[model samples]
Target: MYAAARSMSRRVAAAIAVFVVYLSLAPPVFPFGAVVVHRAAAQELDDEGEFSYRRDAGNGPARWGVIRREWSACAYGHLQSPIGLSDTVAGLADRPGRLGRTYRPAAASLVNRGHDIMVRFNTDAGGVLVDGVAYRLRQMHWHAPSEHAINGRRYDLELHMLHQSADGNKYAVVAQLYRIGRRRDRTISRIEEYIERIAKRKDHEELIDEVVDPRRPVRGSTIYYKYTGSFTTPPCTEGVTWLVAQKVRRVRRRQVRLLRNAVHDGARRNARPLQEANGRGIGFYYTSPAHGMVATGG
Candidate 1:
C-alpha cells in the first residue's frame, strides 16, 4: 500500500513539472492584440477628430496615452515605433530573400479619415508572411513628413500598408518612404484624384469599390528594414511588425502637398512624432544592385 501511494505521488509531481515548463516556454499571446483587427476594431483605428498631429495641442501625440484609459500603451509601452532607421542601431535579424508577400488586385475602397486618406480592401486581398505566420492586407494609408526616418533623415511622405494576421491577433505594417522629386509616384498617381474627391466630400466616404492591386513597385522591395514596434496612433498597440524599405522612392512635391492638404486642419501634417528606440535593433535585408539579396550582420 505504501509503495503504491508513493508511486502515485511521483506521477502527480511530474505532471506539475511538465505544466510549469510549458508555461515558461509558451509565447505570450495577446488577443488579436490587432490578434489584431476586426471590421469594428479597424474602424476604431481610423483617426477620428479625437486626435491631433499638432505637438502643442492638448490632444496631440504627447498626450495620446492620457487622452484615454485604454491608450495607456501610447505613453507607457516600451516597444514603440517610428524610431530612426539607422545602421548604427541595426540588429542581426537578417533573413534570406525579400519580404514574403502574395498580394494581388482586390476590391478596395478609399476613405478620408480626417487625419489621412486610407484605402481599405473590400474583398479577399492577399497577405504577407512573417516568421511563417500569415498576415492579411487590410488597408493602406499615408503619412506626410515620413514617420520613421532613415539614418536620421526624414522623407517627404510615407505609405503604411496595415495587415492583420490570419487569426486577427497580430498586426504588421509595410512602410515605404518617398522623397519629393520631379516624377510623381505611380501608386499615388493611381489614386490622387480619388484623394481629392475625399477632401471635397462632406461625409469623407467614397462609396465606390475599385480593383486595387497591392503588388508591384509596392511589394517589389529589394531591401527592407524589420523591427518590432507599435502602431503610430492610438491605443498605440505594441507588438506590431514594422518593415520599412531601405531604398527611398520618389514623388512629386505637389503630390506630397496634396496628401497633407487633403486632411483636416490640425492633422494636415499627419505624422506621429518619432518614439524612443528602447534599445531595439533595426534589421536590414539589403538586395541593392551593388549587393545582391543578402542579410547584413549586427
Candidate 2:
C-alpha cells in the first residue's frame, strides 16, 4: 500500500509538470479576448498616437485607408485633394471678384504638427469672403515640393490657408504655389525665425508677440482656380472649397528649409501624392470688372 501511494504521488507530480510546460508555451488569453501583440511601445505611440499617416514606408499613402477604420475615404473617396490641374480646363465667366481680403495684423503661434509647420492665428486674425459668404481664417500650413500641380508641373513649395464659415459646416482652403527665387516671401521669412523653437515637438504650439498679416502671401493675386474637394490628410473630410491662386510666388530656399526642418528634420518630404480628378471640373477665373473668372466642374 505504501509503494502504491508513492507511485501515485510521482504520477500526479509528472502530470502537474506537463501542464505547467504547456501553459508556458501557449499564448496568454483572457476571459474577453486574446492578448494583443504589440511590436514596439515607443514606435506605436509616436506622435502621441494622434496621426498614423506617413509619406513613405509601411504607413505611407497607400496604406492610409487601412490604418484606421475612419480613414477608409482616403482609399475609396471620389473627391481627393492635391489634384493636378489640366491645361484645357473649362473657363468660367468673369464676375466682380468677391474674394474678400481684409486680413488684419494679429498675434499667431508657430507649431510643429508632426506632418507640417502650421501657423495658428489668434481670435483677432481676420479672414476672406467668397461669393458673399464670410469665412474666417483659422490656420495655415505648408507642404514641401508642392502638392497641387499646374499643367502636370509641380512647383517648389505650396501653402494652404484654411478657413471655415461662421456656421462651421463649410470649409474653404486657399492654396498658393511657390517657386525658388532670389527674394523669400517676407511672410514666410518672418515666421521662419521661430522654427527652431518648435522643431520636432509634435503638437507643440508657441505664441509670438510679433503681429502677422495673413494677406502678405497673396497680396495682389485676383486670379485663381476654384474647386470643391476634401482634406488632403487622413479622414480626408470632404466639402472643402479649394481656391488655388493663378500666380506662383517666390520663396527662398532657406525659408523652405526652415519650415521643412521644423516638421520632418529635413529627411523626408511631406506632400501627399496627386489624387485622381474623377471627372471633376475646375474653374479658372481672373478678376474682371464684370464679377470674375469662374470655371465649371472644379
Candidate 3:
C-alpha cells in the first residue's frame, strides 16, 4: 500500500510541474473584443519618384490619393502646419483706393487668452489706451526665423496675436515680425524675464502662466497683408483667416539667442518652408486701399 501511494503522489507532482511549464511558455491572453491592430492611409515623400498609384502604399504622394483606415497611420497624412501670418494672405480681394483714416481708443477689456493664468491690458489707436472697438484677445504664441519673407528676407522672431469674433466664427491673426536690432522692446523684456524662469524648470504648463502681461502695450502699425491658409500642424486643415502686419518689430539679438537656447530641441530654426500657393490669392491692406495679387502655385 505504501509503495502504491508513493507512485500516485509522484504522478500528481509530475502533472503539476508540466502544467507550470505550459503556463510559463504560453502567450498572454488579452481581453475579448479588443482591437489588436489599426489601419490608415499615410503620407510619404516620394524620395525615388516612382510614379504609380498602387506602387505607393499608405497615404500616397501629393499626386496620388490614398485613404487611410486607421487613425495612427493616417495621422501623418493629415494636413497640419506651423502658425504663420504670411500663409494667411491668400485669396483675399483687393480694396482699391486710399484707406479711410480712422482713430479709435483702446478698450480696457483686452483679455489675454494665452494658455491659462489670464493677463489683462488696455489699448488705444496710437498707443496703449482703454476703450475702442473690442477685439477679444484669443491666444498668443511664437514663430522662429519669421514666416513673412520681405523681398526674400526672413526675420528672427515673430509673434502671433490671434483674435476671434464674439460668435467664434470669424477669425483673424495679427502677426508682428521681429528683427534683430540694437533697440530692445520693453514688453519683450518683461515677458523674457519670466520665460527664463520657466526654462530652468522645463515645465511647459507652469510656464504658460508666467509669460503673459496685459499692461504691455500692443505696438506696430495696423497696415497688414491678409490671406487664407491652413494651420501649420498635423491635419493641416485649411480655411483660416490671416492678417499679417506689414511693419516689423525689433528685438535684441541676445534676446533671440536666449529664446533659441532656452527652448527644447535647442535648434534656433522652427519656420517651415513655403508650400505651393495652390491657386490662392494674396491680399495687401495698403494705406490707400486693399489690393489682391494672385500667387503662382509653388
Candidate 4:
C-alpha cells in the first residue's frame, strides 16, 4: 500500500509540471486596453469580443447585430460609417470654423488587433479643434480598399485617426484616403515600414520608435467631408463626427501589402461597405478656389 501511494504521488507531480509548461507556452491574448479609457466605454465598444471578418459562419458585419444584445445598432442603426461622399451635398467653408490641429510627433505603439492594426498616440500630442471644442488624439487604424468613397470612388486605402473630446463623450474621426501610385508619400511610407516590422505577429503588439509623426498625412489638406456617422466596428455607436480628407494621397502597393499581411484568416481587407445616407446631408469643408466660395450652410 505504501509503494502504491508513493507512485500515485509521483504521477500527480508530473501532471502538475506538464500543466505549468502548457500555461507558459500559451500565446498571450491582449484585450485592447488603456487607450479605450473607461471600463464601461470599452465594454460598450465590445473591446473584448472576438469580432472577426469571416462571413462563412455568421461572423461578418451583417451578423454583428445578432451576436450581442448591445450590438443591435450594427444592423438597426441608420447613421453608419464608410458612407459615400457626394458632390451634390451643400459645401461648407473652412473659414471662421476651420479645423485646428496642433498634432506633433510622439511615442506611439502598434498593435495587431486581429481585426486591424491600430496605432495609439500619446494624448499629449495635441489634438484637433472642431467647432471650438478640443478633441485629443487617441489612436488611428487602417482599412483596406477604402471604407468611405469619394464621389462614388473607392481608393486603395483609408486611415481613420480617432479623437475624443475633453468629456470623452464626443468623438471625431479624421480620415485620409490613399490610391496606389508612383509618388512615395513620406508619411505613409514611414508608417508602412513600421507595420512591416510587426506584420507576422498574431494577437501581438510592439512599440515603435518615436520617428513617426501623426500629423504628416493631414499636413497639406484643407478640404474635407464632414458628417455624422457611427463606429464601423461592433456596438456601431452613432453620433461620431467624421471628417474625411478630400485631398487623396498616393501609397505604394507594397505598403498596402504590409497591412494585408498583418491581419488574420486572410481578412486583411477590413473595410465596411458604404452605408445608406438615410436623408443625412453632407457638408464639404474646403479652401480651394476651384470649388467656388465655400458656403456655410448645408
Highest lDDT against the true fold, candidate:
1
TM-score of each: 0.77, 0.78, 0.53, 0.76
Off by over 4 Å in 1: 1-48, 91-98, 200-203, 217-220, 286-298
Candidate 3 least-lDDT 10 residues: 110-119
The candidate 1 region of ten consecutive residues with least summed lDDT is: 289-298
Positional deviation of 100 in candidate 3, in angstroms? 12
Off by over 4 Å in 4: 1-49, 55-57, 92-97, 286-298
Residue pairs in clash, model 4: none
Estimate every model's Cα lDDT from 0 to 1. Answer: 0.80, 0.78, 0.47, 0.78
| lDDT per residue (tens digit) for residues 142-199 in model 4 | 8888999998899999989999999989999999999999876676566676677677
lDDT of 1: 0.80
Candidate 2 displacement at residue 270 in angstroms: 0.8
RMSD of 3: 12.2
- Cα lDDT of model 1 by residue, 1-298, tens digit: 9999999999999999999999888866665354455445434534445778899876789988877789999999999888888765564444433467788888878898878888888898898877777899999989998999998899989999999997889999999998888978877788877888888343476744457887854745667788899999888999999889888888899998888888887877888999898878677644442333334532
Per-residue lDDT tens digits for candidate 2, residues 134-240, read 89999998898898998788998999999999999999998999999998799887866687788888788889779888878987777778877889888888778
What is the Cα-based lDDT of residue 93 in candidate 3? Answer: 49
Output the TM-score of candidate 1.
0.77
Find the number of clashing residue pairs for candidate 3. 34
